[model samples]
Target: MRQRIILDVDTGVDDSLALLYLLASPDAEIAGIASTAGNVPAAQVAINNLAWLELARAPEIEVALGAADPLEIPLRTTEDTHGPHGVGYAELPTPIRRISTRSAAQMWVDLVRRHPGELVGLCTGPLTNLALALREEPDLPRLLRRLVIMGGAFNHPGNTTPTTEWNIHVDPEAAKVVFDAFSFAPPDRRPIVCALDITESIEMRPTHLIRLAERAGSHPIETVSPADPPEARSVASNPIIRHLTDAVRFYFDFHDGYDLGYLAHMHDPFAAAVALDPALARTRPATVDIELEGALTRATTVADWAGIWGRPPNADIVVGTDPVRFFDRMIARIGDHARALYPGQPVGDPVTRLR
Candidate 1:
């Protein structure tokens, strides 16, 4: 049976990729998409969400705009990372579809209530929407089949600050509320956190992007001639691969600046993958708390890995993943979707598909 799921996103580069990954997966039944403010304004996030669904030809799924800012903190956006439109270098045409009138928190409450004990909530952005839903309906934690979050850096250094990951840091209070909501839930109901510790381990270098692009029958390099404009080489007949390659180029550029060798971490996609198939990564139970006020430690996800805190475990933290296998699965599913979308097109290499 296909997993009924809702994606909570900020619609940035990685978030967009996560949407694509889930849309391409046969096991995922995307019930809805809830947009939050993190990578850009909530409005832009909603736009990106609708655009992606339209591109994937999955307009039947609902899309809703969430919080414009965190519960108490001033909103901060990461336009530098995701570009002005929150989709990096790719430019998506405006979608004709309209967002649902219901708020994101309302959508969450309605969807879970409609499919009690059968819906997975995959959050790849700030926890504001989830927290709001929890406040409105206290039983949300128990209703969800599972919750998977792509935030925090329990054992690894943070990508935003020395001790805070971007998503949680964007809204610590919201994160705290969501974590506390699950604190008393059963182990199986607690949130599964795909933190930076494991996500950072699965890096997609240029070669991987090249392979994905090739699979879509798009040229990896736009142009080899120095005289030709850089944009000329990015033209691809496959819209899906074209958009993926263009958006990834911006991400690759950002990582290159960090001397990471043009590699982008598969953070949100890993979380989405785990939401669809929990066995993709190994997890351990741990008590998690978000630091609300510590000057330099605010928004840090403190995992009680040693059991000294005496607090009940609130989250299952992912610690390991098989990069090769994970990528193989992801690429194959994406290729399958592309092929299904355009039957006669030359979908690139079949090696990954064979797996």
Candidate 2:
């Protein structure tokens, strides 16, 4: 049976790729998508989700809008990291599909109850929506088949503050609630935490984009460079290739600006892959908690890796993975799916497709 999943995203550039990764994978069956506040505002995130589904011509999937703000703190969005609208330089068309009437929290609660013991929850954004859902349905931790979260920095340099990751930093209270609630989960069902320590290693350089475009048989195979004008857009023949190229290019530029290099971290998509196939991750079981009271370390993920806490491990923290294998899988699946959607030059002679 295909693994069933509900994705909660902030629709950041990486989050957009995560959605595409799930759609491209034959083994995944996306039940719904929740748009939460983080990379951009919740409303804009919902719009991006709808726009992407339309652009991909994907099967109809419910897109639910999450709370306008975080659980406690004021909403914080990183438009500089992601573009103004969260999707970087990609300008996807507005979708005709309407957002679901159910709020993101309601949608989460409803879907998990409907597919108890079968629905996998994947959160590539803040834990706001899931925390709200947990409040509505206290048994969610037991009902979910599994949960994979892309947040935290755990032993790695923080992407937000000196010690906090973006997702957790945005809503530490929500993150705390999630970690505390899932403590009772069985060993097999503990949340798989894909923190920055591992995700930073899943970097996507400009060459990876070229490989993806070429794999999809898109003509004028793309090349992104640090010297390219920031306003330059992709002209790849395939629509998917064009948008992804544009999006990843912006991400590349963002990283380079921070002296991190001209490559983007595939954080969300890596977590998405582990959600479907846990074997993709190498995890270390730990009692995980959020630092809510720290003056300078608030929102930091605290992993008791040495059993000093005397509490059961609530999270299986990913510490290692082979990034090369992941990029290979990403290129193959997304490339094939894109080619199928917009058939381009055949295997060798990159031409154009006309229905």
User: Cα deviation of 67 in candidate 1 (Å)?
Assistant: 0.9
Q: Cα RMSDs of all predictions?
A: 3.7, 2.7
Question: Per-residue CA lDDT of candidate 1, range 1-355, in tens?
Answer: 8998989999999898899999998788999899999999999999999998888888488899998989998999988788788877788979998999999999999998888999999999999999999998889989999999999998799999998999999999999999999998988898999999998888876567655655555432332112323253256556787777667767766776677766788788888899999999899999999998799999999999878988889999998989888888877777567656655665443332100
For candidate 2, write residues 1-355 as lDDT tens digits: 6999999999999999999999999999999999999999999999999999998889999999999999888999999999988988889997899999999999999998998999999999999999999999989999999999999998889999989999999999999999999898788889999999999999999889878888888877768888888678888888998999888888999999999999999999999999999999899999999988879999999999999989999999998899999999999999989999997464554432211
Cand. 2 TM to true fold = 0.97
> Candidate 2, after superposition: displacement of residue 27 in Å?
0.4
Model 1 weakest lDDT span, ten residues long? 221-230
Angstrom error at residue 355, model 1: 32
* True lDDT of residue 153, candidate 1: 93
